[model samples]
Target: MAKANVKTVEKAVEKVVNLPAGEKIERDGGEVTALDAASIRLVMQGWEIRKKIDELDAQLKSINAQLIEAHGAGASLVVHGVCRASIAEREAVKITNAERLKAVLGFRFTDLVKTEIAYKPEAKLIEMAADGDEPMAPSIRECLTVGKSASVTWRAEK
Candidate 1:
């Protein structure tokens, strides 16, 4: 047996994309080629499966909430001779008044706080300054950095 060449494969792929509706190309062993139609169909099927999975997940969450309400938190239970489930408790802290709290507990507050500097371009401010508008602010006008980024995206045609 001989291996297929890259050019041959590319041509085959191009042919597949340009195939007319209701037409299919097959390999030697009656295997269907992965053409645009098959690819689109698979994508649509995957979306449908994702929707069903989301629905099942919501139902499971509702059932879990009911079970937790009936048995209380941290109660372990077995179901279907396979699954074991339990609801665990966790604690979280949110700082409502950082400035006031820091004033009250000076050194201790430093332990809980993190500070960092981030650099970003102010394009609009730069443009305004370029167009002869009043300087946005003396301090920021001098400190603003300029940069560019490029990205690519793909979408299906409507």
Candidate 2:
């Protein structure tokens, strides 16, 4: 039993290591290649759970699509001892381009849409700060601490 478990774990580790992107994770100073076993195990567990969820979600979506196709739009389905599923419709009012609408509407745009001044970081200034060189270096340092977070696109297929 222990041997089988160890082999299973080894295969999991091999699979993760064989992957191009997920092998080394980034740390404060640089990428860390040698991760602890517990950390790796936790990540593997999360991956396994997410894979199962993705499979279930795909199946649910396909089944829902079938139901919608069979019933057409704005319909419902009831399964005995189960539940009711809906393809109910609702109107969504969306202003995709508020700037264009404001330009075209002139004054009446205010009635429909509320506007506010939004301050956003400029990329060049951030780059200058990162490179430790610029006229805006002091200002960028004072005003902003530019940082990045992980962005994940799940690979559904192994």
Candidate 3:
């Protein structure tokens, strides 16, 4: 396959950016405003690039799975200058009948058991809290801490 000419795309983008606002350009047997054309082109190019990336990622995952199946976990091998593949085993605990175990063991198993507290306030609850209204749930009021954060969201106009 021939290599893509990245310079051509860059030049097209520069032309669109330099065009005055509300100026229209003629292309593809139709006239479109420079901003509109550029926006459409960017979204199309983004989708094409994302599709190619997803395809390559799926192929790589399949090859990795095959390697792991053939050699088993904790397998490592180098393939010349390309890359090295390694699979390692991980240990995890699976709990069954936590309440029954806790009941039978009583205080002796207290060290093995852990308690975690987290607070997720609802929009209405946040507003109520700001106005000094107590939370309906005591646990929520005990663990809740209000804070502010800044974030930005971007999406295609469609």
Candidate 4:
């Protein structure tokens, strides 16, 4: 795995030390003389922030997996229903629409499911949602509708 270029406590301290004089170097012991000491607080804070980010990433991955599974199951049910409706009612048009839906919402969705989904490209749906409009699937299906757009918040869903 690729490591992040994080500024550790030591690095932070080094930065402060390297800076020209006339700048304040406040520390708990009434001002720090060494770079290592200066970095102590900053390093701890950075570590905490990194830990939180890792935890959030794990949670997000789990949620994305669940969403992908749910979407897959939903697609399967829809497909089965379309097959049954087509056979019983002989509604070829409905079958065609169902096939299209499967291709778009089911098959296409799998490709989009991932650990992180960004939605900047799906500005239309976001805009609609911001405008107090209900953002349904088909409305935003064209733009990164799968994993790329899956990382949405509870507020966005509501």
Best by TM-score: 1
lDDT of 2 by residue, 28-116 (tens): 77766866656667788899999999999898777866766677656655665556676644432233444544454457445534445
lDDT score for candidate 3 against the true structure:
0.53
**Backbone clashes, candidate 1:** 0
Query: Tens digits of per-residue lDDT for model 3 on 45-146?
Result: 888999999999898777766766777666666666565656655532223344544454466334544433522334544343345554333432333444
Which sections of candidate 2 miss by over 4 Å? 1-26, 31-33, 96-100, 116-158
lDDT digits (tens) for residues 1-158 of candidate 1: 13568778887788666755442466566766444667666666788999999999898777876776777666666655456676654432233444554454466444434433522223443444345445333333344334432221222332
Candidate 4, poorest ten consecutive residues by summed lDDT: 85-94
lDDT of 2 at 152: 18
Give stretches of model 1 more than 4 Å off.
1-35, 112-158
TM-score for each predicted model, relative to the true structure: 0.48, 0.46, 0.45, 0.27
Model 2 RMSD in Å is: 18.0
How displaced is residue 115 in candidate 1, in Å? 5.9
RMSD (Å) per prediction:
19.9, 18.0, 18.1, 20.0
- Superposition error at 116 for model 2 (Å): 6.7
In candidate 2, residue 135 scores what lDDT?
A: 56
Task: Write down the lDDT of every candidate, Cα atoms only.
Answer: 0.52, 0.56, 0.53, 0.42
Tens digit of per-residue lDDT, candidate 4, span 30-142: 77454444455566678899999999999977865665555532222223323211111111111113233335446543333322332132233334323544434543343
Order the candidates by TM-score, highest first.
Answer: 1, 2, 3, 4
